[model samples]
Target: MAKERSIPAPMANPETEPFWAAAREGRFLIKRCTACGKAHWYPRACCPHCMSEATEWVESPGRGTIYSLSVMKRAPEVYAVAYVTLEEGPTMMTNIVECDYDSLAIGQAVQIAWRPTAEGGPPYPVFKPR
Candidate 1:
């Protein structure tokens, strides 16, 4: 098996600690605004929709379709980075693995798989073809 990469430690502020904890448990979470019924990423204390402090954390299905992608040919190694628009309406920056760089397409179905990190932080959520 390939060695997993190290993920950087989260800042661990009050707003984002719960999110980091959830990711360590192999679950993906997003902040949902109770007031406006909208979900958002990069968790914040207040809802971006209504600026209300009424927000809650909810588990995500870890499923999404590729919204956009870039093939890195000049970077450290050949890899693909994508903005995956989650079914719950938040687009997250993630890496797409287990597929050839030339084979990825927009709107391709993907499911999350946790890649363990050597940094002792949360595992990185990577997408693979479903």
Candidate 2:
């Protein structure tokens, strides 16, 4: 059965406000360091690679491949969590939704899916098999 997991609202500070704002519009975002030219997962003011403050926000295609996954059958609700390596580069920890948990496999292509916030904040990114 495909069940919906209870998604909590994400809190946003100044550094992550833009990300949350874009999420509300159903867009996925990642940070790219202008100096190092490497994209990073967590949005921050500075680049983790070159320690450069010259970073900019770039919209992700929201496509990725599953690096690893685990199904939490012991939880109150069954769900799958995974490290999805985004097409942009960085791997993000996220949930896999809208599919049979047993059907997921490593290297499977997936696309971003949004789970709306119950607290009326920005939606969160999840992945569904493509």
Each prediction's TM-score versus the true structure? 0.87, 0.94
Clashes of each: 0, 0
Which tens-of-lDDT digit does each residue in 24-54 have in candidate 2?
8989889999999999988999998899999
lDDT of 1 by residue, 1-130 (tens): 2223346755678888887788888898899999999999778988877899999999999999999999777534666789999999989999888877788999999999887665577776889888
Q: Which portions of model 1 show Cα errors greater than 4 Å?
A: 1-6, 74-76
| Candidate 2: 10-residue stretch with minimal lDDT | 1-10
Q: lDDT scores for all predictions?
A: 0.84, 0.91
Those runs of model 2 whose alpha carbons end farther than 4 Å from true positions after fitting are: none
